[model samples]
Every structure is written in C-alpha cells, then in structure tokens.
Target: MTLKSIHIEDTDLQIEVKEVRKVSKIRYALKKLIYVPDADLKPKIITKILTHIRNIIENKVKEREEKDHEIGIFIAYKGKFIKGMVIAEDNPHYSSRNRRAASFGWLYAKDYEVCKELMEACESFARKRGKKLLRGPINFPKSVGGYGLQVEGFDEQLIYGVAFNDPKTAPSLKEFLEDLNYKQDSEYLSMEVTQDRWKSGTQLDKDIKIRYLTFEELNNRKDEILDILRGAFYSVLPDAFGMERYKEIMDLLRNIPSHYYKLPKKIKLENDSVQTEFVEAWKKCYDREVITFFHLAFDKNTDNLVGIITCLPDLYELWKDNPITRVNVDVAAVRKGYGRKGIFSSLNNIGQLTGNMLGITYYEGTSIWNLNEDAIRTILPHGRINRRFYVFQKRIKNPT
Candidate 1:
C-alpha cells in the first residue's frame, strides 16, 4: 500500500485504486488520504466521510467486489494532502446498463486551485479510459452519500444522507465547477409534500386495476419491478438506472431504524457475498402501513403490471428513536406508453390519503431527476422543493 505519487510541480497526485490491488495496500493508501472535512463538507453532513469513507473503499477493493467501483484521487499541496475525489472508473453493473462516462464523487477541496487540481485529475483518468464524458458527485451505489452537488436547500435537513456541502463552501464549489466548463448534466429535486386533498376520488377504467404492492408480492416479483423500472426510466434518464436496483433492499441505512448508535445492518465484519438478509429485508421492511405507498398498477385485461411507485418510512426518525411520522417516496415508474395516463396520480393519491389518515406529518419525494418532466409537473404542484442537486458534466478529449 505504498503511496503511488505523481508529482505535478507543486501538487502531488495519488490514486488509491489505479494500480494498487493488494488489500493491505488499499488500507495503507486510504489511511494516508486527506481527512480534512472542514475544507470539503457542506452543512449537516458533519464530516461523514471521516468516519465512513474507509468502508466505501474497503468494500470496493475486495477480491470479488466490482472492479470499476471507485478509485480515490488525492491532491496534496506542499507535502500535505488537501483535496480528494472518488472516481468510478467504468461501471458496476451489466455491460448493457453501461454508459460511456466516469463518475466523480465524494468531492472536497479547500479552495479554487485545489478543486481545479482535483477535477483535472478526474479528467485525466476519464480520458485514459476513452470515456466521452465525466459527470458526478455520483458516489457509487446510491446507498452511501448518493449523487449530486448541493446547489440549493442548504437550510433543510440532510434527509437520508444525500450529498450536501458546507454552505459556505458549496457556492464556491458550484461556481468553480461551472467555471471549469462542467455543464449541468442533470438536476434532481428532493421534495416535501402535503398529504391533504387526495381522497380516492378518481375512478379507474375497469380494465385497469390498482392495489398496494404487498411485501409478499415484492418478494416474488422483483424481476417485474426491475423490468417496469428499466422500461419506464430508460428514456427519461438511463444512467440513473445504474444508480438504482430492486434485487434487494436498495439502501440499508435509509431503511432500518437503529436500536442503538443507529448501526447499519448491512455491514459484515468480513463477507464477500451478498447476504440473504438484505433480500428478505426488502420485503420485510415494507410490512408496515407505509407499505400502502408501494403502489402497483396492472392492465386488468392482461393482468400485466404497467405502473408503480414506492416509498418507505423515513427511518431517520426511528434512528433517532422517534415515532414514525413521515415517509420518503423513493422511486416511481410507469411504463413508456402508460406514463402520462394518470397512473402515478392514482397511486400517489392513495398514498397521500393513507398518510393523512395516519397523521404522518409530511411525505418526501426523494431525488426526482429533472428529465422526467411528467413527474415534475405531476408532483411539483402538490409539494415544495426542499433540496436540489446537480451532476455536472464535461466532454473529455478521448485519445482512443
């Protein structure tokens, strides 16, 4: 794990995952990386990486873990490492789910020069890989730290640990990335909505049937959910699919309510295989009344699922040992032709009415990508935007 240093005059560049493959070497390299949270963090994140960053790389470096998971880029000035970025090299999914871009995430630097240096390192890595574009703040897997640069809603709570920057540092970071020609690839909104006004008022066509997707059904029907998700999402935002999955419980920390220090159940002392618990928990966690939010729409004529929306209790409430008073509407999808035909409304209305009856204070719709205008148009009127994010992109000059 000796450091692989690339000296660029006053700056020192070392990539944690570039060539180092030995497990011990990865640990050594990580321990030596920059840990200055104040320089990079935005409000409410509380330097989460200082404590959790090691886990991110450890899982990726394992012998059987995905190879393109993450490569840490550390920039040092005057013998002191100042900035760091995690570069997602190629992909972690099947090749057909692939996109020709690199993801830069866990971005943090003290100032413009350090930030510039960090970004240049990212472009260099992408170019070598022959990737056409570099885009991020997309920390791998969408479980830990998720995606986006916090461009708005600094005052709001850091719901489900989506990326947030130090308010003082975030604006400067945004200006710097924009100045560096990283165009906005996409934007996402985290919304807080009211539960009022939805009262089972719409009558559905007799040929269409709607019902809450029970845990039993979700357990048996993940393939159906994934199909509905991919078919519905591919056109609006394809790469976002890479950030999502339904094979198991998608994000653990977002699901399980902690009984102690809010310990995550996903962590294993040493295990390379995906645990059976994760798959079972996907259905088990939705067992409560909030399960009503897992709406499924089917063509009664053929009995084929055509639309869906899902949410879970905001376990952050329970992590704090508070009673569950809210749900975060996490994912929604309707197959291509059925998208605008009011399926989501019927689904959402049922959830809202259910929430209102249960006295859930508010429901959050998390991370809705801006490309889905139909979703934006449908959900925006009923809620106010609570948080906003951007994944900036820059076309790279690929030699290959």
Candidate 2:
C-alpha cells in the first residue's frame, strides 16, 4: 500500500478504482495468469508459462533500470480483488510524437471498466513525465508480446515477437481500446515463410556480392555497416519497423558490456532470461559458426555495404526442449539507391538457402508495417499474413 489511491471513473456505474503500486501487496495479481486459446489463439500456453511471463515483466518493472524505466499498476476492486493491470514505461527506442512519449502495455482486464481505469492510470503516469500523448499495447519486445494488438489474420500460426492476448476469458483488449477512443498509431504484419528447397547462392550480380557475414566480419565492419544502415533508416516513417531503435543500437552494438561476455551460455530469450539491458538483448543475431544466417549485400566495385537482412532462432522452442529450427526474419532493408535492383531478393534468397542448410526449416517474416508500401509489397508475397499488429495512441491530460 505504499502509493495506493482511490479514484472515480466517468462511467455510469461510478465504480471505485483502487491502485496498487507494489506487486507483493496484491496476492491476487497472479489470477490473471489463466489461459485458454480463443477464436484466434492456438495451442494454449498453460498457467505456469503465464506465471513465468509475469515474473520477467514484474522483475523488470520493479528494477526500473536505465532506459528500461517501468511501472506496473494493478486496478484493485474494493481494495482487494485484482480487476486489471497495465505497465507504463519509457521506451528510448520508440519513435513517435518526436519521441516525447511513454508506452502502456503488458495489459489485462476482466471487463471494459477495469480496462478504462488502467488506460487512464497509464495516461496520468505519462503526463507526470511531461508527456501529452501515450501509445501502445507493445507488451514488451520479445515473444508473447511483440508490438501490437492483433486485429486480423488470427487463424495463421503464431510467430515469435508478435503480441498475443494470454487469457481469452477477458474481453478483447483491441475492442476495449477502441471503446476508449485510442486511435491507430501504426500497423504491422507478420508472415510465415518457408524454403523447402535451396536456391542458387551464386552472386546475383557481378557488382553485388551476397554473403553471410561471420562474427569477425561484423565486428570488423560494424562501423561502416551501421553508417549505411543509419542512412537507410533515418528518414523511415516513425512508428513503423524502421524505428529509431537502430540509431540507439549504434552504441549498444559497438560497446558490449562486460556482463554480455560473461553469460553462462548463449542466453535463450525466455521467461527465465534475466538479460534486460539493451546490450544484453542480444537482439542482433550475429552469425557464428553454423548459425551463419545474417546476410549482407555489398557493391563489389565500390566495396560498400548496400543491403542487409537479420534474423534469430525462435527461442520459445527452447521451452519444449526441441531443436530450434524456426527463425524470425527481424529486419531486411536496401539503401535508397539500392532499391528496385535484385539486391534485396538476392540477399533474402541467400539467407533462405543458408538458413535451410543450417537445419532451419521455418521462417517468420516479422515487423513489416503496412505504411511502408515497399516492405508490404516485398514481404507479403512470400506468405499470407499470419498476424496483424497495430499500435494505439491516446492524448494524456497535462498534470496539474
């Protein structure tokens, strides 16, 4: 009950919304862990898995580390029962409203009333930091919750890094947000692609060399490669996949903290993973040994990096103790002048061929935004939409 408070909502019922800032004070917080695969969800994750998910989020929220600053709020009914919960946090990588905003995600509510209370509570949390707008359902940037509420394509297979509602018993968060007047901020798509056969790995063009970059090459050419990336992505539409996250990663990729090198083993990104910092995110799937899948296209004559595609193994499979065979194609882009040429296709084809050679059987083309016509046209053709993601925004009233 450290920072508890009672408030009233604008609805007809005039219910009392009690806030609990400390997770320990509310033992009923874990009740929201129930799970049932709904109209769209498949292969329901049991309550233990949900408990694991809650632990990772709860620990990070409590730690309040550097750019990962976060707060978990529980909307209590009559000061006891847990009606709903939401997480408010600062995302330094977020590119919207000139980056002067916060995110509200890791959401849950039994009904619209609790959802409304949670959303407004997040709004108040935003304004206190001098922000006038808030956006999300981002959930957190890994499996379970990738970047938005699913609005379409529910019958398809679930992929890594895309957000999905854990418990189906509650009203859809998408509907609740719409009822709250939260407008669409961005739209994204995830597609399932497969390469049953290998393709020609021959250099597509005499001037364009497509090859997998080993860790040595990446470590050596990171500065030159990142410069090209910065140029290609800097002007990309904000809130889209071409987010400012790349710009923020310059230092993160360049300077690996001491802890990263000391990890007991290659950290599998899951509920037990404690690697929360941007550096530890190991988000960049650096090709090592047979894991060589990150493909880069370069100008043979100019010897300048021209295009790139990045990917990572689906870490969730580790939970089932199965060989990790699926991959998430997280990023793919060609420079401004490099478009329309076969550079992108060449790089991607080479990526697929090499991925299959390394025992990878499935691929999820993720984070392709609808607003980025170039991305949609290029990526959607590979496979049908597996899931649709959207970001929502609502204006926050200034704090008095």
Task: Report the Cα lDDT for residue 307, model 1.
Answer: 79
Clashes of 1: 6
In model 1, which regions exceed 4 Å deviation?
1-70, 73-77, 81-89, 94-98, 198-201, 214-216, 231-234, 247-293, 339-341, 356-359
lDDT of 1 by residue, 223-324 (tens): 777777765543546355433345324444235433311213354322333223222323333334224446677886777888787766654555455776
Model 2 misplaced regions, further than 4 Å = 1-31, 34-72, 166-171, 194-203, 216-235, 240-291
> In candidate 1, what residue range of length 10 has the lowest lDDT sum?
273-282
Clashes of 2: 1
Candidate 1 colliding pairs? 1-25, 41-166, 42-165, 42-166, 43-165, 43-166
lDDT of 2: 0.58
